[model samples]
Target: MKKMSLLKVDKLTVQFGGIKALTAIDFEMEEKEILAIIGPNGAGKTTLFNCVSGVYHPTSGEILFDGESLLGLSPEPVATQVIPRDRHAEFFCSLGMIAGTAERIAVNLRLFQRTEVSELFEPFGKGQKGSSAMPHKRNPILAENITGLARTVRSYVSPALEDMVLWHERDISHSSVERMIAPDATSLCEFLLYRLAKVIAGVEVDEARIRANMEITQGLVFSEAVLLALVRSGQPRQKAYEAVQRCAMAARSGQGTFFDLLSRDPLISELLPPRELDQLFDLNHHLRHVPTILDRVLHKE
Candidate 1:
């Protein structure tokens, strides 16, 4: 099953001088499955793409496509990276929208605003057809390029939403640059995904690494557990708030686990029994809602 499933990257890394941009990154994709790599900016997501697609070779580590190593392949050598499925739809949609809108805008400018194609700019000869020996020669090419670039800009508009997901992460930093890159990344990724899906197989999942990532969220994820326990007991809101806050502070400071702190605190222990407390600490308690949420989304019921 694993061997038939296709293109996978194993331990890819990119370094710039002494700094490691990507540190031993690993990824894989099964045929027709959509995998998204999302993180805060500077999290090495794009660097991983560049390495896998062969635009840039990792300073160290390996990329494999269908059991063949693509470590040294350049962009031109490898089949182009396929565009992602959603982005492909977006790109074509934007293209059609731009072409229709441009024609209408051009008509409006020519009729109501007293604008002509020649009069639109200084480079061309007034009222003359396109000329070969002068600057006018490039105007059509320039206009075409602008039209294409505009379509590119309109695609991948979703990432702007993703960019704003971070509370304090909002800065004009992504705004100006995302103006150009968001479209290009979406368009290019969609293309690559399309081309590679058939030829490539599947991605490798490193279970140990995934488990390690989940570990980092440990005590932070337990905040809801503590809150629910306090609420179910019918305790006054302020009292519950104070107890949870005190334990959270202790946990944050590395004094002890939140559950341990709650167990030791006489007031909280009085409010909840040991069995209920243990249930609150279990990670699976939070995940019990997953099947319900997934069913609602998939069935739309």
Candidate 2:
């Protein structure tokens, strides 16, 4: 009989600057499989363990635990220290709830909300029977189905939480709940997780659509940055807020682009010249903190 995989790693890679700490490592382990990584010093064994323990983020790859992803999840290494063994079911229940949220996010992206200019996303395969539905005749069947399964998994959380409230004599009420929910929730959750992973893997981003949709709001998205810049230039808070809001409202009302309207406004013109105002709307203003955020996440902060 073919053994079920308890742990699966595919195309795992880790890089540090110009050095590759691990390069496309691949392996699988079955339940109770006694496998060892036999290697001398600096052979990436430590790097692999770091990846598993959430100390390091893999540069690229997949790591599945009982068909659910460990690497894709944000780490809570500290929880392992404090969580009692009995809370394993609760942990699984919480994981199910998280997976439900994740699955819905995936569904929304695949459904790819339509904007004035374009649909923002499409993650489904061509094989999906989108032809029969109203979504441009394309249905997000896979993502939607996974969402339903995720809700089923989330349903178990209530009972699992209640399972902790048995009588002081330790009656078997929780035991019976465990007997039924344990297998059902776990089996279903594992399947749900595996399917969610597949959905996320197949997701595709439409750069053109994304950029186009970003323009749908006519640069009003940068209003906050404009407001901040106005304040930094010594504009009073109420005055700056009103100026930015007026410019935003003008943009929404089909006035010329937000920048043009702001430039024409006498007060805004004095506070923010074209060059300075232009800089405020640059997309990089929002992305400047990405590297720091990435570093924190990679370090499990």
Candidate 3:
């Protein structure tokens, strides 16, 4: 069987007014295959690359990336602006939950950096191997420390909230809790935030492992897209829902890939052909909308 091309550019042509930059360029690349194009000045190298990147549209022919057309994605330039910060009065009672987000992230890092699992991060300092006994081990001990500190900060939150419910304005219990927790939570939060910054700054990212982990779900992530597409194809909502659920269950039970099972289903095969089915299972398809979302966030419209 011939290997499928991850990227295919056929009969590509580009022109700027009457000057032709490129003509009749054709190429096919397999997944994980690297190909370098070398050329001197005015050889249309950048133009060809730009065409594939969706920066410049081809005057003729087609460009397909991972089975999806890379056409009509040229983005408009978004203006840049500064975000100003403001000082606000404290609601120290709720500080636990806010600082708890850091705790949540630290907990994740603590788990994900385990040896056999994603194993994608090591938030250790320079010359630190993260382990004293195992030379190859790099544990998230810093994140673990941060987690303990965040827990201490949160321990004071209950007292603070209970103090809010007290009847007297000058309750001795409330005043005592304030005098103790005020400095403790504030100082601990400041220290945790600083240590978290340091740990993150010293983090070592394993990009290859991250990419391999992206496929750990066995294409199950695209099931929602398939479900919606089936509903759009005139199938009843419950019918589509049940069909998709069955396929997903089969995939989990080690039958086959999610896409293979969905495409082989009689009802889904008739509604969504192989081409549309291939498009639905793409990760980059979801990522292509990120720029537009960032535009909205920046413009705040």
Candidate 4:
């Protein structure tokens, strides 16, 4: 009995318009054996892979699997078996998701920094003028940079998804796309992660501004709390919901503060006294469970 080679590439050469990308490369792999091709950038590793996977028509050479010629076969079979394993799509998709999430966070941070108070994030750099002509400008350029980088990272998702549906068993269509996206997307995501960390670490949060913004809704944010309180106080669920909705709508349309609207509603005042109603509007009521949630999330309790 003899061990058989699972894959073999002999005398492989690939050329691109008179430029030889791969020159007489030879390699073999046995079943269940791992092989790594180590080289610096532009050392033809990708070209060699293309030749072996039938993405590029080799100038000369042969590829064999278990002694059968792979030259005339569709690229899918070879590419699927030798190049991209089952986890390739999952791995890249995860990176795209991370990039997208980071992008969203950066966008939100930028928006917060631009709001009227403009105190969510401290002005970038001491005396760092946002505009030369204006002489009184501060910008969220770091967040903007993350946003731009995320665009490039997100663009790679389509190709990765398309690569998941190669023709028959494999096709060269995804080859060029993968070659560009795989490295670029992962690299962009890496940069985004680091950039976000730096931004978050250096960011100066305005607790007062956060509290001020939370109050902008003018007690309407506590509508859910009021509703829950009404229900817990033995009010019919639908009645409680309707009462909360009416008050919320009035407050939202600038009729009055939600507390005032609810306080004046005869149906609500009968169920809860003014003091209890005021307690329902307290921000602490909504945040009472924050510590528990944080503990669960951080695995601390």
lDDT of 3 at 137: 75
Model 2 lDDT tens row, 22-119:
99999999887888998999999999998987789999998889888887666554343233224756676676777677677757855584444345
Q: Which window of 10 residues has the lowest lDDT sum in candidate 4?
A: 78-87
lDDT of each: 0.60, 0.77, 0.80, 0.83
lDDT digits (tens) for residues 97-184 of candidate 1: 5544553443432332122222232123356555456743424332343344445545545554344433343335445645676556
Worst 10 residues of 1 by lDDT: 113-122
What lDDT tens digits, residue by residue, belong to model 3 across residues 1-301? 8766899999999999999999999999997799998889999999999898777899998999888889887454531221111100135646687579779888888788887775547455569776678888777887888899999988887776676544333335566777888888998899988888887776777777866786776788898899999999999999999999999999999999888899899999999999999998877887899999989988995
lDDT of 4 at 288: 93
Error of 1 at 236 (Å): 2.2
Worst 10 residues of 3 by lDDT: 80-89
Candidate 2 regions with alpha-carbon error over 4 angstroms: 1-89, 111-123, 133-136, 298-301
Clashes of each: 20, 3, 0, 2
Relative to the unseen true structure, what is the C-alpha lDDT of residue 202 in candidate 2, on a scale of 0 to 100? 69
* Model with the higher lDDT, candidate 1 or 4: 4
Q: How far is each candidate from the true structure, as Cα RMSD in Å? A: 27.9, 13.7, 24.1, 11.8
TM-score of each: 0.36, 0.65, 0.61, 0.65
Positional deviation of residue 267's Cα in model 2 after best superposition, in angstroms: 1.6
Q: Which one wins by lDDT: 3 or 4?
A: 4
- The segments of candidate 1 whose C-alpha lies over 4 angstroms from its true place after superposition are 1-204, 216-218, 298-301
